[model samples]
Target: MTILLVEDEDRLAAALIELFHAEKYLADHALRRAGKKTPVLMLTARDEIRDKIEGLDQGADDYMTKPFVPEELLARVRALSRRQGEVLLDELRFGDLCLSLATNELNAKGQSVRLAYKEAELLKLLIANKGVILSKETILRKLWGDESDAVENNVEAYVSFLRKKLGFLQSSVRIQAIRRQGYLLLEEEAL
Candidate 1:
């Protein structure tokens, strides 16, 4: 799972980022431009009712004030992750492959394989937009959000992993790279 820290304080941001990493979460600072699907836990020095309300109203999935306990912050982050996962419970199917969003498992040809969070998310995006080329920039922005640190190589890595999983499952679905365009999911003909 990933967490975006929007705290402007450098020292606080570093400490929180370290905590999240220690907890095995992919954590990063908030981007300049928002609109990320990833669950956000906004941390700020403002500790007023109106401030919290405004943060939530501005699209933060969760909000916390300064001088908070680490345990509570972790718990809130977990809750947000759970909530996001709940929305993806519906299974996605394309050709002979089935992706279970709840379990993050992919099944095909009598075999089932588990996927990491990012891998499952990337696969879902590709499958959802089947036959449509998704640009590297789009994938980065959607999956990794607008974090400037994320690069095209990150998208390529995940796509490579998904391709290996598909090959292992012997699925007809293929992720095709369209040179300068991007990637598109295609069902291959049986030989």
Candidate 2:
């Protein structure tokens, strides 16, 4: 996750950046202005509510003031991250294969292949977190909606199915096991 921290206070910004990093968030500082398309969390000591509102108007996901608790900031960032995950939709591509979330279609080399609901969800999560190791619990919660009755092996089954579909697509996107850790999406070249 990419987070933009817009704080003019040098010491506080550095401390918060460290805190965010400790929480496993990739935080970037915005000294002058926001960058292209990155999610932002603006911080300001400006008492006027307009300053906060203006930051949000400028595309910040959330805004905070000074004397704020670290826990509160972390919570807000987590909420924004969850919101982004929930609304994830776009034309996702990996290698030569492309999947259109809007159209619910998978295409490769100008040909289409059918994918089941679970298979598509699994593929989307893997593609979204590509190059990052996703734990088993994380994958299960994402695909199975945090239901306890959902067996852990369900992820394995869907992954297997996705592998077959990728084969049909003639693509090399594969779910690779990391022994005790979980899995990583490996491209044909990476594999």
Candidate 3:
């Protein structure tokens, strides 16, 4: 799961403040890395308009000043989290296949089928990490989230579901179960 880096100005030491200043200069790099889906809520004591503008421009999903009400701070965080789950409509492509992260649709060979949310996420993960074996534990943590009750069987079931969908779409790409290891996404020709 993604985490929020809650940097409070009052808690920072002099050197740390300087480091944060450097981070402002590097905001461009940080923006690209965080992308649109990652929720960034910046907490700072600096209430200047420019500082707020800079933080927002730097890709913070939301910004709040110091001395914020404890309840309101929590509300904003929850709001941001809910917003993150909203449809961004981003697409991840690999080989002949395309998976829509927002709508959970998988497409290939001019054919498409809707997938469950978990299935789409799993496909995206495999596509992004093609050729790398993803252990069951990693899958559980990523797809089911940290400290999830999901087990290896849950991963296997979703892999099975995705493989069937790939076949249905007539996609050249496929997911292979690596026994005693994990899973791999590959074209049939790569076998």
Candidate 4:
């Protein structure tokens, strides 16, 4: 027998990784608590109301008992997937850069850089909306949630971080800041 531990910093990957891989009755409380909010579906043999209640309170977005029908399982997953407006792909690309959704690593020109979780999310947002202006309000709402205390400075800092990484990679892609507007992703030649 072998054991594995999944500790991805990305919330979605971290929450779901163990569920698909591990089937034991054991629940990794620490794993569930690893990152920020994620859509988690807890699967276990325990069918008790108390168990289900505890699971839900412990951060599970959904719960399933043992011997679940495969179709129902798929449907539940689909529902959770829709909860997050953005469907995470294996990778996202713009110009010469590739952002790995699973590992939060950005690659360009044969070189790679690991980004902090927030940095990755910001970069993903920018890539998904390449050439479109994304206001600070929009970025804050989407990435940090409306209720978060993150201010414009937070957004500015992350943007600066991404810019430095892009420079280090020597990628043609660059993030352009619109005065009193927002930020846009554009290749250097597009200037």
Candidate 5:
């Protein structure tokens, strides 16, 4: 969690650095050449949209303006960290296989597979709702944000997509469809 405090104010920057350090954050000042890895956060007094965009475009995971509440900034930073970690976890395992949330990469008994965007989203939703029978309406609402506009059949299509991807990935977990009810993300052992 390296934070790039780009504020021109010496005293304020120093205080923020100290505060982040106290929170066990490995924060640093100044920007460096971007490469793979390390979350960056930019803090500046510049409230302009251009400044915010520039900061993010420069590889900062999050950007904050000055005179902001420190707690709010901390919350944002923590959320970003959690999201990143969730994506990278090696295996969302049910039995013998695991789903890579980071890359949508899958590994099962030595086999590896990639998931499409919609497939991954649907799989994630199912996993999040593991053990719960997710109704078609509920799944549609979650995916398309509007149940009325998007047909319920889209959920069925996506579930099929996920099942195919998971099969290719050799995952033990299965998406079980209950007639007239909905779908459930069932672990191998549970089934």
Candidate 6:
């Protein structure tokens, strides 16, 4: 998979780009001028909570703090690639809700709405494992990678976004938070 490595440190960027190349993964040091379908792995020395949050908020697929292990970095990249490949189906369905991976749209009843990258990824996860409770940690790892500084609240925020989109489409499917358990996608009548 192609990785956009946004690192300002010259030495670190060169090392990472070399490592990714050695592992047979394409990597670039600069950010693309336009949005890309390829996953991004942001490498930065900024480790403050707000910095990490801002990186994620601005659409970095995953974030890695400086002083990281090369092994862990490779693993995170593989995880992102795996998740990218897992959704081979063009569309996922639950009740009346339809999530289109190709178009990045969520449709329900007679309405359809485009989804942001992360939103579509989160919804795809829930729908792929419908009726299963995915813990906040699991969601965080699947969507943001383990190396990311994202917390449970990040998952909650995305869940809230998907919930609003579902509501906007008048969907019968609901993303139900299971308190101590996590979240499960269920039909409204099942709740």
The alpha-carbon RMSD values of the candidates against the true structure, listed in the order shown, are 6.9, 10.9, 10.8, 11.6, 14.1, 13.6
lDDT of 4 by residue, 110-159 (tens): 99999997898788678756778999988776567545788999999999
lDDT of 6 by residue, 1-191 (tens): 56778877755676676687456455566674566677888988899999999988787889999789989998998899887884324566789987765778888888999998789778866875688999998787666654678999999999999999988998888898898999999998887
Using TM-score as the measure, the top candidate is: 4
Candidate 2 — which residues are off by over 4 angstroms? Answer: 1-37, 40-60, 63-90
CA lDDT, every model vs. true structure: 0.80, 0.73, 0.68, 0.70, 0.69, 0.79
Clashing pairs in 4: none
Error (Å) of candidate 4 at residue 136 is: 0.9
**Which of candidates 1 and 6 reaches a greater lDDT?**
1
lDDT of 3 by residue, 100-135 (tens): 655778889999999986787677668656899989
TM-scores of all models? Answer: 0.54, 0.56, 0.55, 0.57, 0.53, 0.55
Looking at model 2, how many pairs of residues clash?
0
For model 2, how does the per-residue alpha-carbon lDDT over 1-191 read when each residue is reduced to its tens digit? 65777877756766786687456455556643645665678878775888878878878778888779989999898888887774433566788779876564788876888787677767766776789898878777555544346777888788788877777777766778899888898887986
What TM-score does candidate 1 reach?
A: 0.54
RMSD in angstroms, candidate 1?
Answer: 6.9
TM-score of 2: 0.56
Q: Top lDDT: which candidate number?
A: 1
lDDT of 2: 0.73
Estimate the lDDT of model 5: 0.69
Rank list by TM-score? 4, 2, 3, 6, 1, 5
In candidate 2, residue 63 scores what lDDT? Answer: 82
Off by over 4 Å in 1: 1-89
Better of 3 and 6 by lDDT: 6
